[model samples]
Target: MSLKWVDVQEIAIQLVDSRPGVDPRFVNFVDLHQWVLALPEFNDDPRHGGEKVLEAIQAAWIEEAD
Candidate 1:
């Protein structure tokens, strides 16, 4: 499935798998945004994501990490 910025949960899951042992809690939004854009499955407007979306992804990633 194509991933947009709104697919925060899926993005988080992918991040968790791609970045093992990395702590999402300490990640900045800028890096997170770049990381999401770098995902092979991600296909959406680069300008679509905002701080809120990034936060949601981070939260989901943190949860997945646990």
Candidate 2:
């Protein structure tokens, strides 16, 4: 499933807002991905790559709003 840039931005912002100690500027997906990757638990997640994490977030978002 393809994701729009705005959608990615929105999701990233929401995630950043929800998490503790996350900077608001990390709404930028690339930065967000890099930040997330640094977290130990994320190493075990299948969506390890930046693109995959973005895609997975989009997919989960679609499922959640339905």
List, residue by residue over 1-66, the lDDT tens digit for candidate 1: 899988888999999999897899999989999999999999999888888889899999999999
lDDT of 2 by residue, 3-59 (tens): 343344445445544564644432455755655454333433425445665666645
lDDT of candidate 2 at residue 41, scale 0 to 100: 32
Count of clashes in candidate 1: 0
| lDDT of candidates 1 onward, in order | 0.92, 0.49
Tell me, by lDDT, which candidate is best: 1
The parts of candidate 2 lying over 4 Å away from their true place are 1-18, 21-26, 44-52, 58-66
Tell me model 1's lDDT, rounded to 2 decimals: 0.92
Instruction: Give the 10-residue window scoring lowest on summed lDDT in candidate 1.
Output: 46-55
After superposition on all C-alphas, the RMSD of every candidate to the true structure, in Å, is 0.7, 9.0
* TM-score of candidate 2 relative to the true fold: 0.34
What lDDT is obtained when candidate 2 is compared to the true structure?
A: 0.49
